[model samples]
Target: MQKPSIPRGTRDFGPIQMAKRNYIFNTIRSVYEKYGFAQLETPTMENLSVLTGKYGDEGDQLLFKVLNSGDFLSKTEENDYQVGSKALLPKIAEKGLRYDLTVPFARYVVMHRNEISFPFKRYQIQPVWRADRPQKGRYREFYQCDADVVGTNSLICEAEIIAMINEVFNNLQLPDFTIKINNRKVLVGITEVIGATGKEADFCVAIDKLDKIGIEKVNEELIQRGFTQQNINKLKPVFEFEGSIVEKLQFLTTYFAQSETGLEGVKETQEILKYLDSYKLENDHLELDLTLARGLSYYTGTIFEVKANGVQIGSITGGGRYDNLTGVFGLKDVSGVGISFGVDRIYDVLEELDLYPAETGAQVQVMIVNFGSEMTASGLSLLQKLRTQGIRSEMYPDAVKMKKQMSYANNLNIPFVVLIGEDEMKSGDYTLKNMLDGEQAAYKINDLISKIKNSH
Candidate 1:
């Protein structure tokens, strides 16, 4: 038989990992619920037509297409089909694993428009697949924790998303970080002022890497993309300008004064800022970053990306406003803004910073001693009573020696051990040992449960 193995870019999460992941998911889910957003899910495979031409060129390349099932070449000559597979693959494969939740949500909205309420607020926690090469933080298969508000043009949704992001990181007790906010229209304004309108895509894509690739290389990329020296020079100051959000907005007022669209972008950003100020979260938590041009093509108005302080990882989370995500599906004028939390990256930050609660992997809380057949029965009875009290109590299956049982408990990091030998059984008591401090005491069953419940 072939040796058993799973595919690359996939992970098998064990109990402890699942527990930690559950903790993360539940925390995010609770926050999403608190904001009154309902949950929604889309299928893993969507029609190829719906999925394609949605994500931009690079994103389309990374989509995982599903081959037609059951003798897919029945209609074609064998040799000709083999020859044409390279060109005809997309046509033959009519479905694909979804790339992200946002696009699929758009498709869902269009298909179910009649059944849904307006200004729909929904949260989706689902696994999305990509065909890209796997890396430390980037994976071909991973989960996206997404929350989007659709069918409304109100900037309140944008502010709510910002506040949601803030609440999530804050509740996670994440260390210092900043939520970088920008507007795509502001990007368009920059392109217009610099005389590079249609080339806005290229400009946005290049500057999106300013954090990763630096400004020098970004300029070189712009020039390579056919931007003139004068254009690059005009756009360079917008990036190089750094100060308080107030100062930056002031500078932008003068810079984008000539362009009406740029001014509107500035106004939208200021409105979000004013909301931020009125709500008055930690002032340091939000920043107006001119360089934050998230490269995704769907974003139309506001854009957001978050970075962890003192870490080398890329943006830990990002999302933006899409003016017509559903319009592509024939549902026009339905605007939406959403955000996705990069769970894997957040896990990496927590691991590096040692912020995960030490008790995160804790499974067993109490272990009972199995002395002999009779003592074991007694121990089992006590274990049942402890478990009924909500303690994760278990006994060693074998009638192991006392020292061996103790060693087992120590290895498992079980915090409490209950000794129920013949004497303790006869005395109607059990010896509870605190593994960490090695303190031992004999107590009645009720007293033991009370102590464990109270202390632990």
Candidate 2:
């Protein structure tokens, strides 16, 4: 028999893992709902045309394409394959697994434009696929909890997204995190200020790696990308600029004074900061990070990325503003802002810190030990009553040995076990045992429900 294995970068969650994951999802969903964002779901695959060119060069290469169905080679020109698979890809593959929720959401807004209201607020929690290499906290398949608002350019949306970020990590009881904010226009301004206007994409892509590869390699990359050494010299101050959020903003304001677009980005950042100051976030801090250029080509305005305080992983949440994502899909002039929580990475952070609440992984609160066939009926009756009371209880499926059934309960960490053999059934009561303390008592159905409900 062939050994069973899952694909690399994918995972199969067990019962306890799923429960902890659900806890994360449920917490995010509740916060999203409180913010008035409606839930949305998109298909796992999207048309190749809808996905390509949306995420920029590196992102496009990471898309997992679906092959054309049924004798795909018959439709391809023999000569096309000789050139290269990349050259012949379009002739065979027409669909791809979704790379992220934002692009699919853009398509949705355009297709359903007439049916939905303007400034539509929506939240989506779904698994997305990517063809990237797998590593710790990076997966080929993972869930993204995304919340977005479209059709409005209000800075309020950006501010609220920051608040939502704060709320989510705080609710999860995660340690200190920093919400790094930036503007694509500001990056554009930086390019213009340094006289590298035409190479904005290359510039952003290089600087975005400042955190990963450090300044030396980044400067080397910029030089290789054909930027003149003199222009590169001009960018040294930006690389070195640091201090409080306000101080950084002050420096950027003076630095980009000559670049109109850059100044506008500065103004937008200031406005967002102004609004954010009115709210208090317990564990998260907002900071201006000029180097925080989200490498996605689609983001035209504000960008955000969140990093956990003490974890050694990438951003657990990220997103930004897209001015006209829908325009690519034949819808014009709509703007949107969004953020996505990286569920898998967040799971890693929580696990590493041992932060999950004690009850988050509890699947069953109680179990009924099956003494024998004679007592099975009585056990089933009590099980039904307990379940009806909204208690997570189960009876042993078969009349197993007493020791074995007790072992099952112990292994499952079931806190309470009810032993309903002939003696207890005759007395119209159940023998309830507290697994933790090894205490035993007999109680009527009402008292049994109350006792179990009140037990840890």
Candidate 2's TM-score reads 0.98
Query: Clashing pairs in model 1?
Result: none
Taking the tens digit of each residue's C-alpha lDDT, what string does model 1 give over 300-386?
Answer: 999999999998888888999999888889989999999998787787787788777766776888898878777867887888888
Off by over 4 Å in 2: 282-284
Q: lDDT of all predictions, in order shown?
A: 0.86, 0.91
What are the RMSDs of all candidates, in order? 2.2, 1.2
Tell me, by lDDT, which candidate is best. Answer: 2
For candidate 2, write residues 23-95 as lDDT tens digits. Answer: 9999999999999999999999999999999988899999999999998777788789789988799888999
lDDT of 2: 0.91
